[model samples]
Target chain A: MRPTVHDIAAAAGVSLATVDRVLNRRPGVRHVTREKVENAIREIGYVRDVAAANLAKGRTYPLVFILPASDNSFMHGLNDEVRAAIARSSVERTAIRTLEVPAFDPAALVKVLNELGEERPAGIALVATDAPEVRDVVDRLVKDGIPVVTLVSDLTGSQRHHYAGVDNIAAGRTAARLLGRFLGGAKGEIAVLAGSMLVRDHRERLEGFAAVIAAEFPSLSILPVIEGRDDPEMAHMLVADALSKKGDIIGVYSLGAGNRGLIRALKEKAVDRSLTVVAHELTTHTRAALLDGTIDAILNQDAGHEVRSAIRVLKAKADGLAVIEAQERIRLDIFLKDNLP
Target chain B: MRPTVHDIAAAAGVSLATVDRVLNRRPGVRHVTREKVENAIREIGYVRDVAAANLAKGRTYPLVFILPASDNSFMHGLNDEVRAAIARSSVERTAIRTLEVPAFDPAALVKVLNELGEERPAGIALVATDAPEVRDVVDRLVKDGIPVVTLVSDLTGSQRHHYAGVDNIAAGRTAARLLGRFLGGAKGEIAVLAGSMLVRDHRERLEGFAAVIAAEFPSLSILPVIEGRDDPEMAHMLVADALSKKGDIIGVYSLGAGNRGLIRALKEKAVDRSLTVVAHELTTHTRAALLDGTIDAILNQDAGHEVRSAIRVLKAKADGLAVIEAQERIRLDIFLKDNLP
Candidate 1:
């Protein structure tokens, strides 16, 4: 027979009630007593059967997801996936709640983090605003014995346990390489469209794109990025204006969301011109654009995978269990018109 | 206030013991009695918590993996992933066994399937041979109440519950587009390499590749396929001879294994040739070749993902539960030098 709570209690020289409290993580157990019980359980090689334990104790993992209040297809898709997870809350024993804050506002994110410290949830997952203040709060939360994971946009130089997103730099580098190679010795300028450089993912993408373009494709020159703030109207206007002004531009790389406007601009301004385009995200607009020859390639991160990975990592951390690292890796999905899924 | 087995028993007008037999799948209950209990479960919307039930009964799902005895990097990687799953058998509550048979031998596969009827494993996952005999055996297993999943390669016109692999046709179509566009307006013949035309995946890839190239890329023409038998010596010899003879061949597509041999052939014969190559699978040899410009792009299926997905689907089927459809999709990973991982 497997080792039981009774065995743990015996080994720890503690009462069954104390063992029960420690096992269920209930209050009123002294710190020394808890450690003693934990040590005994470890020494006895007791495998805590989570499914049975959850049923017996009604153990629930209270997980919080902090997202940006950005109106984009990607963000909407992410919210949908979180809602789906919420629907499975009963079966999975997870109580998930979402909090949205102003995009790129470090102070707002920090305020939410501070509030979460008081709530003491089992785990917290967030799209971090890459700022020192946000990092400080995240580090503080880790120090306070909370499991923290960064979602789509990661927090740099922080004590976060895991990042449930792709390598933004590699995504950017891939975009640059695809665009550069597709152009194939064509001497021309390239236009870059981005939501904003303030966010770490966007910045990292730009950095990688620029680095690869400079080192490998010296014939193709990169023009200044058109920051449309990920708004369709703003992106359309800026892209159309840029395309009209830059007649020598042969390629376009949309490194961030809001591709609806970019597609509209490409069709209107670059229809007669022989221009190659690469983009991010696989929204309906981008998918159609790719099929119609407006975009050559798309580099995407699956929002569903990110959300699921975040929840899995958070749950594993909560349970003090190691996750399958390879399984949790959010692979960058590169889609061409032929391989769109 | 969730519905319990006792509630089900009361609703079904059966004894608690009868309800327990139906729930645990014990062989004592009559067919009509089982149906009544099942109908009661459905009517009351009683959710079966697998974790709790597994703990109560120590239920172990007996899953068998059938693989081809091919000595290649991809097959080796897949075997490693299966071994990894076997290592986690205790935590996952799985009793996994693997059977290897000759590659592309449908008769051998059918023999194994016929023998498995007596053993009656909870689930079976197999790399299908795509023969009528294999399909018939798979259908028989499904009819016999065994949950069946096709891994890596799928069996067509069969009753397999799921296919834990990529869409090979899409992969081939994407490869053709990538190769076609990368070559620009250059008029040349393309060399097609394959392990054999017997497997469904290889045949589908060629079909998609041919259709796309014929429909879109008018300037490029395909040469006769060189069967390498997934052997390094055979692939190297055939590829080297083809490159030597077909000076007009500007691009190459390796739709199957033996990429190591292809890489060696490229280095030995086409060292200075500006040949555009697209290949399947991303092993160490292929990754290095991609970085060195020997292979321009790599199309891959995550073996780990497929293995885990098969296990999850099997477990869910055994427990009469539903799987998250989107979560179980095995995506095709497209790797360029810039985004190797």
Candidate 2:
């Protein structure tokens, strides 16, 4: 049988109330008494039944999800996942509400975050805009004893508790290697596409992609990156122009969400050209593109996984508990047509 | 507040005892009463607090994991993951024990299954041998109300509830495509490596790989399969002999284990030959090979995820609950050197 509060009390030579206070991390117990109770808990191998404890206490986590109001498939999917989580709030003992700030607007993100300090939720998760002011506000919230985690895109130089996303740099490097090996020893220009240069994820991806290409595949030179702002029409126009102007472009690495645009450009213009392509995000469009041979592979981060991880992390932090890091890791899924989930 | 058993009883116009009997699937409840309780549960959204309910009953799940006693890295890793799960049995309220039968011995596997009927575990997860005797025993267990799931290698035409592994056919097809694309129209023979033809996964992988090669890459031809028994020494000897005898072989697909020996063979005898290689399972040796350019790509099914998913499915089955199919899907992870976890 598992040890209980009585066992800890007896071991620590303390009263049951003192043991309960120590177990709950309540501030009333003196340091020496708390340490004694803690040591007793360790010695007796006592484990708290957290679910039962929370049920008795009628505890509910009020969580706020701050999302970028972006007109992109990925962001929309992220929002949908959050909504799904919200639907489970009653059973999960969570009260989740999502706040949408203007995309890439650091000032607006900071404003929302500062307002959260007044009506502080148990935790906050956001797609960070990678600005100094935003980082400062997040750190302040964390300092105020609120759990904060970055979703999808992470803040730079921040003390956020966790990141619920894939390693963007590694993703970019993987893309480069896939493109390089798929193209063989063909010496040609490779076009790079991005959502924006302002986001840290995009910049990191570009950096890793360029580093790998420069070091390993010297035969292939990367053309200037085209910022599409995750807009399909803009991406299509930009990619089409790049393809038309550069007949030597033999490959493409799209490291962002406007894959519908990228796939359209490839199908319309590059159908006659034997250009190998690798793109990001596994949406309906990207999956079809991969299946039809328009795109070679897709590097994907499961939105469900990211959202779930964020929620799990937030709950754990609120409970003063640690999560198994391996279980919490958001793996980078490399999807080929054969292994599409 | 979430609805409770009291609420379910009031809504269903039943006694607390009737609600309890229906909720726990006790044999005493009438069909009409059980249906009323179930309908009330749905209407009032009375989700069971499974953990708390189990805690109240002091319930513990007795689970059995049957694995093949194969001398290979992948099986060893699988064993490790099972042991890890066993270590967490106390907190998870599970009593998990592992049984290792001789590899590829259907009779031995059947004998173990027959013995488990006497023990009567809540759930059974086994790496099936794909023989009729094994299938029959598994069917009998299911008939007796045991929840059985196939792990890693699946049983063919069995009454198993779920297969907690990747689609071996898809894995094989993917390997074929990767090798075919990497070869780039080179008219050469491809060396096929296997653990054994006795296993379903190996045979299915070979089948899918061959079909894709025949349909897509006509220039590439597959050589005879060399069954390694997943033994490094046997794999090394056979792979070395194959390479020495066939100078036309420009590609290798190591669909099963013993990749350690395959890497050694490639390094020793095929160093001068530029053979595009694809292998299964992510081990230290295979990962190093991929990083060092000895292996082109590694197609891996995370053993940890499989084990965890099996446990989860088993628990859900024991509880007569459903799992999120997407969350439990064992994805085939395509690990390039750049995206190595």
Going through the candidates in order, the fraction of native interface contacts each one reproduces equals 0.75, 0.66
The DockQ score of candidate 2 comes to 0.71
Model 1 chain B weakest 10-residue run by lDDT: B48-57
Clashing pairs in 1: none
TM-scores, one per candidate:
0.94, 0.97
* Native-referenced TM-scores of chain A, all candidate models: 0.91, 0.97
Interface RMSD, all candidates in order, equals 1.4, 1.3
- Model 2, residue B190: distance off in Å is 1.1
Location of the lowest summed lDDT over 10 successive residues in candidate 1 chain A:
A47-56
**Span of 10 residues, lowest total lDDT, candidate 2 chain B:** B85-94
TM-score, model 1 to reference: 0.94
Clashing residue pairs in candidate 2 (N, C-alpha, C atoms within 3 angstroms): none
